[model samples]
Target: MTYAGVNRLLHWLMAALILGLLTLGYYMTYVADYGLYHLHKSVAVVVALLLLPRLVLRWFKPWQSTVKGKGAKAVHGFHWLLLVLLVIMVVSGAAYSGFGGYGIALFDWPLLAQNIDAQQQVVAHSAALSDWGLAVHIYCAWALCFTLAIHALAALKHHFIDRDGTLIRMLVGEKGARL
Candidate 1:
């Protein structure tokens, strides 16, 4: 069965946004400090917002896989784990930004930590939250990269090797596709 257009749209959009975030995130952290934190945080909030609706849609219309047998369990498990990791990333990133004395921003708009010592230097609570949140965020970032690679390779296998409609279902879902 094919996913509806909206579902597929959300899937691809999230995929692009996430991939972009991962690249931008890595560059900002390791490559150079070009002052892209605001952009990263802004886009992250957008991704977080999109995640909610995508999850709700998935709940109502779950995607079915063509793969069966023993590997199916692993595939499903990985997908679920990816979702959980996304939740963790969002929470940890927010904690690091919001509670670390830096207000969470969406293109200069305040989301959180707008007034709570945002002007002052890092406080004790901010430091603690920053420590824990940064640790989790960094770890999860690598985990996310590995999982995403696997997910992409799986999709490629389905499309190229399996030649199943799995990739098609996601790529160009039919109108009013219900299942």
Candidate 2:
């Protein structure tokens, strides 16, 4: 059996989105201009919206498994952990944006309000809250990168070593297909 078409579509779509978000997050943190932060926050919000429904769909619609016993359980557990980490990343990112008093824009629309101070008026800064949010966001993002590496390796192992349909099923949703 293969995954349903819609599930496969969502899976691939989210995979691309998450990868972009991770790359953007890293660049913004280390090598980018200040404006990249705004773009990063907007992308994170998009990921958050897509991920919520995807999680629910994954829980309800089971995929065909190529491995059995402990192997399958381990895969499931890792998937769950990844999802949890991503959710935390999204929440912490939002908190970081809010506590830093910066607004988030969705493409062309305004979602959160920018709180940059006027010359005469000083905005109260909550350094502690911002720091806490930044810590969580950064740590979770790093953890996600590590886990994603394992996930990709696992798929390669299934495709090249196990010679199972696990990777093929995800990629093309074709039953019993091999790499």
Candidate 3:
């Protein structure tokens, strides 16, 4: 089962990082300066990188799902959907950074850009790609936000109302979550 410690560790790490990204994304979009821009890019790049291994792990290792029978499909489907949205978000973010001319970096190392000149290092633009990238990034982010809300609600229902240990399985592991 993918419920091993490494998987849980990765899941929580990504969860915290993604949530931080969401908050940082919102703050940068509406309130702050370019100060956090590099931080945002750094974190995003890490998440993007981390996604691949997590995906591979999940794909190969069968999950011991807490859900059963009828409702399991929806829950499982939603889980996969979250991963799909993550891919979209990561791709679009990279597109925007690279094409939007803002560029990307893992903290300080530049990842994508045509030229790294003094005046036009990462600021060179390809108008179309930039705009499209930004549009998709923003829209998909909001869509992801709503989807996460629903996921959280369902988890809460399972834990608090249903007392079925679904949330426990998610937080811990399937075996550990058993009541």
Worst 10 residues of 1 by lDDT: 170-179
The list of candidate 1 runs beyond 4 A from truth reads: 1-3, 114-124, 174-179
- Report the CA-based lDDT of candidate 3 relative to the real structure: 0.83
Q: Tens digit of lDDT per residue, candidate 1, span 71-148?
A: 778877887788888888999998887767677888888877543546665454567887799899999999999999
Clash count list over all predictions? 0, 0, 0
Q: Ranking under lDDT, best-scoring first?
A: 3, 1, 2
TM-score of every model?
A: 0.87, 0.88, 0.88
Q: Note the Cα lDDT for every prediction shown.
A: 0.81, 0.79, 0.83
Candidate 1: deviation at residue 2, Å? 9.9
**Pairs clashing within candidate 2:** none
| Top lDDT model | 3
Tell me how far the alpha carbon of residue 64 in candidate 2 is from the true structure, in angstroms, after superposition.
Answer: 4.4
TM-score, cand. 1: 0.87
Write model 3 residue lDDT over 18-128, tens digit each, in one string.
999998999999996779988998999899889998899878985556678977788778888889999999998888778877777887687864545686545547779
Better of 2 and 3 by lDDT: 3
Give one digit per residue, the lDDT tens place, for model 2 in 1-179: 23477777877888898899889878877886677776777777788888987788778975546778887888788888988998999888877777767656787677877676667442425667767888999999999999999999998999899987778877776754743
